[model samples]
Target: MAGKKEDEQQKQLEFEQDEVLTVLARSGDASAFNELVRRHRLKAFTWASRISKDPHLSEDIVQEALIRAFLNLNSLAHNHRFLGWFKSIVRNQALMKMRRGGLYRRELPATALQTASMHQASVQVDDINSIMDYLIARSSQAENDGTSKDPQVLLERREWYGIIRAFLRVLTPREKSIFESFFFQECSPQEIAQLFQISVGNVYKIISRSRQKVQEERLSFLIRAQIRQRREDGLLKQNVLDPVSLKESGGSLLTGTEQLYRFVKARHPQLSLSYVDGMLLGAFLLNIEKSSVDMSSTNMIDRNYLITNGMLNLGMRVRYVEAFDFEPPDPNLTTEGIALAQGSVDLGMPAMVWELIHSEFGLIYGYDDMKQQFYGLDTQSDEMVPYEQLGRLQTRSLFVLGFVGDHPISPSDSLWRWCQMISRHARGQDQTFSGFVNGLAAYDTWMDVIRQRAIEPLGHAYTINVLRQSRKHAMICLAELVSEWGEVKSESEINQTIFNLLNKAEEQYAIVHDRYVELALLFPVPSGGEPNEPANAARAIELIKHIKYAEQLGIEWIEQIAERLEEHASRAHVPAIVENPPRAYIM
Candidate 1:
């Protein structure tokens, strides 16, 4: 009687303390709020358990409810009503959790708490109904006919037993023993709990967790078995890539090329996306054709040649296949190209595809031979293309590129090749499209189009966005070079000079990056802002001009770095050998 009286006194003190704490918590006292949680967390869990009836689910509900309450404390009407408001939140959370599980359609009955205690027992009782019915029917038939049991019937029984064994194998040894004793041997949970020397709740939890684990594994095992049987019967030929996600780009052919490059780069730890972009000249490329800023100008160069050259520079042996290259599609070429694409996907390498969906490059990462379909993703989204219509989707052209192997190349050789490519691309020395003005000339054309208000708003905006992102990467690449050079223990004065040049180059690109960013704001994508307006167009022109001058300065410093690399090569004079030379198949 005294203990009960002491409990009442303690409860009175707690309620008074909570009233003061709630007022402090409302005023943004974090420690006061923490004290309130400490006092009420156990009571919250109990309330949630009463409402949810599942202890595991109740735990989650309590946690989420507390977070919601904390986030919404300011909405409480009265400080002294904190407990009531928190209880309401906990109840709402429990209901939401039940609704998501599809278990709360109507109001729960008053006897739900009593019935929930028997739920585990009911499930265990239902497990034997199917097995017992099957056995009883088979025994009755055998006795009445006095004939040998059907072979198929025995096989079915064996299959059921095999499944049981498989499920047991998925459990730990202790779990297997406990589960067998409780379910197969018909031992009560209390007896098992005592035998295992564990609490009754622990026994229930272990059984629940083990059952869920077995059920999940059983489904996966059955699925794989079904697939295997279908394959053996020649009913299916399907291959789906797992755990693959495309590294999206700003909608350029380099998007597809970079995806392919990433797969090949997995074999070389020395390569990174920034490094690849630097080597591919993707970050530095600017091509404006016919004094117009159009869509095609972003990728007007020889795509196949550039991709092949870039991969080779990285020492990756590339396999290139195409059915149409500025020519009519041939059936023979399509067949060869499709076969190679499927083979590359089968080898777990994403194949770069041209016109896979729209009139642009994409990737074919998976296929289904029986369904005659290929799974790919493009700028639009993931798509399933019919196998026979591989090259006839849009442009009636097929182009695919993948890496077969790699050769050895020193970092110095790779850097030198990259610098040479950068210089060539910046100088427009390797421009394949005639009307297109590349490099510094391209920037002038961009400004001319803006000044005349002849810019294609969408294309201009896209160019601004892509180049802005690319130049940001260019800045990162230059900074990476500075760090790499700083790490070299060379005493050569040329090394320090080159490092200084790289820093200067990085600074120029940083300015160029900022200019592009300013332009992007003036002509935000899809909407293109108000670039068609004279004021915005004039501002865009000025930004482009600034970008051009800074880019030119960056290129000058890059050329100086290349000169220093040449000097270093001369000093070594080791007769730099190129073995196998990064082979490519252009067919």
Candidate 2:
């Protein structure tokens, strides 16, 4: 009974004290405002740090959040809810940073809060220190075995700090503050309690939560690194590279920014962005992120390093980027993301890519060096499983229905309409053609790759998968024609065949679409759940919904086309044709 009474008294005193601070701060008292900032800045810093990941950037975010809060003091509804309001400011700042930077393109979405919260939990539960340790260990093991050269090993080792810094940025402001203080500030439970005028035990809880962010950062680093390394080492068995690289620099190993730039340009002619541009953007991202450290780079040498490697230009487009550029998170900032966003809104630059990443990942605002996790990397080079070939059995099935029509030879115009109309639409029913956008981004590469494909024929790529995928759709459409109107031997026949298929496919698609309107159901997810619930499972998740639809339609088309393929198959130089095929597809 005595302890309960004491608890009530303590709460009452804290409440009164909060009321005092609110009144003083609101009354235009600079001293009071400064005092408030002094008391909460660390927590704010931590929150900013978790969201932005870069200490210097996180610090800026903290300052900006405070400034905004102070300027908007008149809008405060309840004095006691000051903490919540402050948190709101930090959250907004972080989200803005992400939306502005293009770091968080988006991922498969579940319902709103549920999906967001789950993503946050994944970022928080992992340990930053442990993840860093694991990454370093991975480097050490690889070094010991001579699997990779010492420089490559060391690069990954050095990047561990970057990973930590990036991960810290992903944390929610509250979580970030807790983790920052626990790890960086070393504020004991007793000291924190006296400072907050709260129970020492509550402080401990906050500290524990902070520690968890560290763990998460570390784990994320290892996981991502492993995925990348596997692809590099040929474990993934895909394309060797995007053809954008320095010819294995023999002795010194391509360190010059100009040399690297030229090499990438030669391989991918239409692609352009310089290293300095990347740094400039990175600095902007970091400064606004401001979770903890000072944002000044006055002490660093090699100013040219940033300038020389910062930008790139391919043809008419100018691209600003960093070597390993990291994009900001989505409009919804994750725990370790950007802290603020300031940019032109016209390009819809802040639009979300709600179908890209796995559900477990959170969006971010800035950078966190110590945490070594980032909101997103600039270039993720991969030979994307061709758009036409990416879906599961069901996704392919839906696509088949979408393209096939009542008249067997008719090709689906719905597919053409989707591709043509969606590239420009913004919202509502206009977004129904979202599948094309998904397909475009799904090409498993950066903008640079697109340029490469544009300048050099797709035939230039070395991957057989690329070859097969590029023509699969054309073949499928051709097959649909044969199924409806029998075999054709001449060019005129083929042209007429294509025409008939296109005209009839629209009708067939509409008929089937009405019958199986449930296809769209595959895309919807339960709210508050990670959108890729199945992807996170031990086994492969279901395919992207539309991809499944395509496969269903394509399979039937392939069966029809395969008969004609036999005649050509008997031709003598299959290998020669594969190596130096005529420009048959494009023409």
Residues 1-587 of candidate 2: C-alpha lDDT, one tens digit per residue:
99657545443433445557777778886556665665566557555544555555556677778889999987998987787788779866864564355133232111112233443432322345333324433544565778555674456445444545566776778666655554444466677677667787787777666555544444455445544554576542221222223232212111232232333343344432222212211111111001111112111112222222222111111111111002222112221111110010111111111111221111111222233222221122212221111111221110000001111111222222222222212111121111122222322221222322221222111121221222232333333434534444344554454455444433433333332233223222222122233332111122223332443343233323323333323423211101111110100
Off by over 4 Å in 2: 1-67, 72-88, 92-213, 216-587
Decoy 1 TM-score against native: 0.52
Output the number of the lDDT-best candidate: 1
- Compute the lDDT of residue 351 as modeled in candidate 2: 10
lDDT of 2 at 412: 25
What lDDT, from 0 to 1, does candidate 2 have?
Answer: 0.34
Candidate 1, residue 5: Cα displacement in angstroms equals: 99
Which residue pairs in candidate 1 have backbone atoms (N, alpha carbon, C) closer than 3 angstroms, thus clashing?
Answer: none
Backbone clashes, candidate 1: 0
lDDT by residue for model 1 (1-587), tens: 99657545444444557778888777887767777886777567756654455556777898899889888999999888898899899977886676466243223322122233332232221223223323343444556776436675455445444546656677899888877676555477899999999988888888877775665454444334444555687652767664244544433335654565455554454655666676666778888855457577665655665666677666776676654433223333355566666666666666777777777677777777656577887766788876555566555566777656665666566666667677777887764555467878778777766765667778878877878877887898888888888876276776788788889999999999999999888888888787768888778778888998999999988888778788777525322322222211111
Tell me the whole-model lDDT of each prediction, alpha carbons only: 0.66, 0.34
